[model samples]
Target: MKKFKIGYRTIKTAVGACIALLIAEYFDLHYFSSAAILTILCIQPTKKKSLNAIYTRIVASLIGMLYAFLALELVGYNPIVLGIMLLVFIPTLVSFKFTDGFISSVVIIMHIYNEANFTVSLLLNELALMAIGFGTALAVNMYMGDLQKDLDQYLKNIEELYRSIFSEIVKYLRNGDTSWDGKEIIEAANLLNKAKSIAFKDVENHLTRKENQFYLYFDMREKQLEIIERVLPKITTLPVMVQQAELVADFMEELANNVHSGNTAKKFRSKLEEVKEEFATMPLPENHEKFLAMASLYQFIEEMDKYLVIKQTFRGIRR
Candidate 1:
């Protein structure tokens, strides 16, 4: 069974709803309970999302009030008119991309319908309820818990996975060891996906910041992981191990040991150039199998070069 725990969002929702209801009741607003409902709907995980929710709710509520006035005052304060109003209002809101506010707007429509009149006092009461609820939710949601520590942890985890993957590659390159299960590839892919998701949420939480360094870092790693996956078959399926394999294995071991957030790709790129020059000076393969093995190793080196180039282009992580 999954463990049950109340998270920060749940606490915020509960507190915001309570504050909305108390404020509405203190002012003796009609249908004060609706304030709590609005609060519940408006409290979102990120500040940007909460702001968008409030904007949609407020706009849709105003539009719903206008529809309620026209349908009930001109036609009749009856169930049939209410149904017809919804039929038109729902489609209109959807077309305008205000679907998020559908429930909140319906509450406003119901209040006007129950009153059976479109009086100024009723309009002001409904507005007051919206103000109290949306305001409380905004105030409560403003204090989002810091996500920097979580993002940092994700970065560390990803680097560790990358290290493990490179170490495994080094082992296979040095010897024809097919014992490894290659679980690190799958694990790295999954971690990158999750890390990118959380990093994007962090970006959303910061309204002024248009870009997040962690998001960029994870995205770069994801691209590099794709290249790594593509080259895995080439490495493992080499027809025969050549002398150059040991050299490549040495480079892989170095990379694996030095997996970190810092930009050291340039240093490695120079070393890679030396390895390529060494390969060019080596004697041609005497057999077909040796030729194939050398070709695969050459391709692997090229792929590794591409990998380092990707990192070289990226600006180092901010301190």
Candidate 2:
């Protein structure tokens, strides 16, 4: 399969950092490199996003410096105290949202503080450096186009997740066993919801300028998710269908795994024909709800089928 890939975030980060360094370099910004570095580091490509990142960084930086001083005062150069500080601080950095930002600010503060060799100086230095770093990162990200791209990527993830669920359900309907990893299902659902929430906030924040396509696409997505929620429970009954549907899922899995035909379409077609035979002849739904739901299941399959066709078309175009 031809994979769609982009590193806009990394590229933006690198360029932003480069520009920041040059800016600092040209103007002799004492904290320029660190500021540029902060811009790169605080990037939300991997996390809560720009505002959260900025907030976390500032909070963490100040809090961390406070922690540093408390540690220093309490431990006071004792090997045991330093060790304890390192132990607590390391996990704290990893665990807390802005600990890394704060710790970094504190460390820089410590350097400047020791340069002046005073506690008050250290605090001032920390605050100054954090402001620079946070400000620089903030400025660069504002102009750069990573956030929209990030939202698109997030939407893509959600799309893949729902598609995967669709595929799993297909397997269940035909194979009679729905025993896939529950954790995976739950994780994908939870994460996509979070991503959706984040994307919604971002779109709202940039409503004045950002594209309306985001809104339209996500509106459809909400419908898709609603359909999925209704359909997901139908999958729970698959264990009873396993004896009849075993070959059904196997074929679907085989077709799904084959991103490229290599003339495997013949085999896939044959397998699909066989599935139609089994599914067509299988016991029909006993009630209106079951029948409507079953019809909807076909609609879900129809969507996947249509998607696979599109995937194939795109592949052909790429080739």
Candidate 3:
């Protein structure tokens, strides 16, 4: 037999379903399958999402039972009464923002017709199933593995891409190097998107009032990359001004070194201001080509300043 590797969430969900079944059997509930079904439905990827699922399902189950009881007592059990009950309750659950519980509520309504009665014992049975299903899901999700390491790895990837991008720009500015085809920008954008998704999931794993710094960090990088994309094309047509290119290349190299450092944002901003001042003091470009080159250099400096400002919003220094 061949073996397959299974994900942690899949394993957790399977365990939760087994636990729910055992608990339902221990309680002598008539519907152990219902508990198992709820466990499967409630086993979400994040603790926060799981908790929300359990809450919504529990509330919807109660509402469903109430409708069942009222229908049995007033209209008496019939296909027409069940239809009316669904017609009334589905919209009610939707209005209360409990749409996620619609299918679970229908299951509860089905149980009433299955047993052909709405007695107190039946109510107790549904409650037991609910308790077993949701409790097992909560227990399984309590152990969220360390996400900080994964988030850090993602940041490191983004930083390396930043280094590549700036290095290419430096090559172009210095000797009009056209070897690089600006592919790094697209790669960095894709990485940033993936990092943001992972960070958002990490936020959902933790139940807290505090913001997820990893998510914020990626978001900041995304904004910086936008500025970089704008600056890349500006360098493509610049006249080779060796002295200016050397300065810009050196500045970019330094900026890449301190990409993940929070303490250096202020320093970088100061250095950029000095560069801008130097451009102001320089003599006017003698030709149209030289003028365009100077204009592109000035704009690049301004964009670098904006990039540093975005980085300043991140919470911590890179490890």
Model 3 C-alpha lDDT per residue in residues 171-287, reported as the tens digit of each score = 787777888988878888998898888889888988983467778888888898888888778876776473566677889988877666355788888988877777677778888
Q: Report the C-alpha lDDT of model 1 over 1-319, residue by residue, as the tens digit.
A: 9999999999999999999999999999999999999999999999899899999999999999999999998999999999998999999999999999999999999999999988999999999999999999999989898999998999999899999889888889887888889898998899989999988888889899888989989999999999999999999888888888988999999999988888999999999998899999888998999999999999998999999998988897888
Model 2, position 145: C-alpha lDDT score:
44
In the order shown, what is each candidate's alpha-carbon RMSD? Answer: 1.1, 12.6, 2.3
What's the ranking of the predictions by lDDT, best on top? 1, 3, 2
TM-score-sorted candidate list, best first = 1, 3, 2
Candidate 2 lDDT at 160 equals 66
The segments of candidate 2 whose C-alpha lies over 4 angstroms from its true place after superposition are 1-6, 22-32, 46-48, 73-79, 86-97, 100-103, 109-116, 119-122, 144-319
Estimate TM-scores for all models.
0.97, 0.44, 0.94
User: Which candidate leads in TM-score?
Assistant: 1
Which number leads on lDDT?
1
lDDT of 2 by residue, 139-221 (tens): 65665444566666765665566557657755566644557664545655566566666566566446254534444444445
lDDT of model number 1: 0.92
Model 3 lDDT-worst window of ten: 236-245
